[model samples]
Target: MMTALLLHGYASGIYSSRRIARAAVERADFMMIVAGDAPDFRTISEFRRRHLKALADLFVQVLKLAEKAGLVKLGHVALDGTKIKANASKHKAMSYD
Candidate 1:
């Protein structure tokens, strides 16, 4: 059950244990997955920490299966800290009286 929670969270683009814990309560899909037995953030974090390598291996295997079934096309994804200026107007700032 815990493994399912973590895997489902990862597949859904949720990596933080805190966010996972929140989703278990707020998201119907997650609630259904856990059968209403939601673990706390600390428990989730500790479980993840203790089984990090195993979890990573399981994720890779699942990805391979997905690629085999044509469910996902694997590709390189990269992110950089290229900052972009916000387009907000100067007038949007609050002024003190």
Candidate 2:
């Protein structure tokens, strides 16, 4: 349940422990994940500190799953108003003048 809350928070671009803790009480999605038992910021921070690596691994897994489900592509790129030399190759995106 806690993991679910944390993951949901991160996925929603809320990286602050205090924000996630507050969301657990205020946001419907977070409340559902926590089942009304909201953890305080300290608890969330401690969990994140202790399991930082594991959480990162899980996040990567989640992103992979999202990609597989066609929600996102792993390495999609977008260029805007940028000029690329016609001679540029894949190895060299752009050359410095």
Candidate 3:
């Protein structure tokens, strides 16, 4: 769980994080225990609202684990803009920001 959440902070979603989690799980090198399935991949707004609190809690747990492991240090970070090719009409997104 700790590994999954840590990977999630670096990656975008659970689907991507799961790949990293699988790799870590394969190696018996770490002391961490892998548990449970990754979160669902649905992108619905309602799902986000419903899971917001749970996600926040999970984030706190991840940070605590990092602190315990002495890995809580800032390093080089990268932010990537999502390239969304919408099939919907562009006019739907044309509004004052």
Instruction: List the candidates' TM-scores in order.
Output: 0.74, 0.74, 0.33
Question: On residues 1-97, what C-alpha lDDT tens digit does candidate 1 reach at each position?
Answer: 8899998898899999999999999999999988998899999999989999998899899999999999999999998999999977767776565
Per-model root-mean-square deviation over C-alphas: 5.7, 9.7, 13.3
Candidate 3 C-alpha lDDT tens digits along 20-76: 445344534321434433333232234445776786787677777887899886467
Look at candidate 1 and give me any clashing residue pairs: none
Local distance difference test, per candidate?
Answer: 0.93, 0.89, 0.51
**Candidates 2 and 3 compared by lDDT, better number:** 2
Top lDDT: which candidate number? 1
Task: Score candidate 1 by lDDT.
Answer: 0.93
Instruction: For candidate 2, list the clashing residue pairs, or say none.
Output: none
Query: What's model 1's TM-score?
Result: 0.74
What total of clashing residue pairs does each candidate reach? 0, 0, 0
TM-score of 2: 0.74
Rank by lDDT, highest first.
Answer: 1, 2, 3
For residue 94, give model 2's deviation from the true position in Å.
36
Which of the two candidates, 1 or 3, achieves a greater lDDT against the reference?
Answer: 1
* 1-97: candidate 2 lDDT, tens digit per residue: 7788888888899999999999998989898998999999999999999999998899899999999999987885887998765955756876575
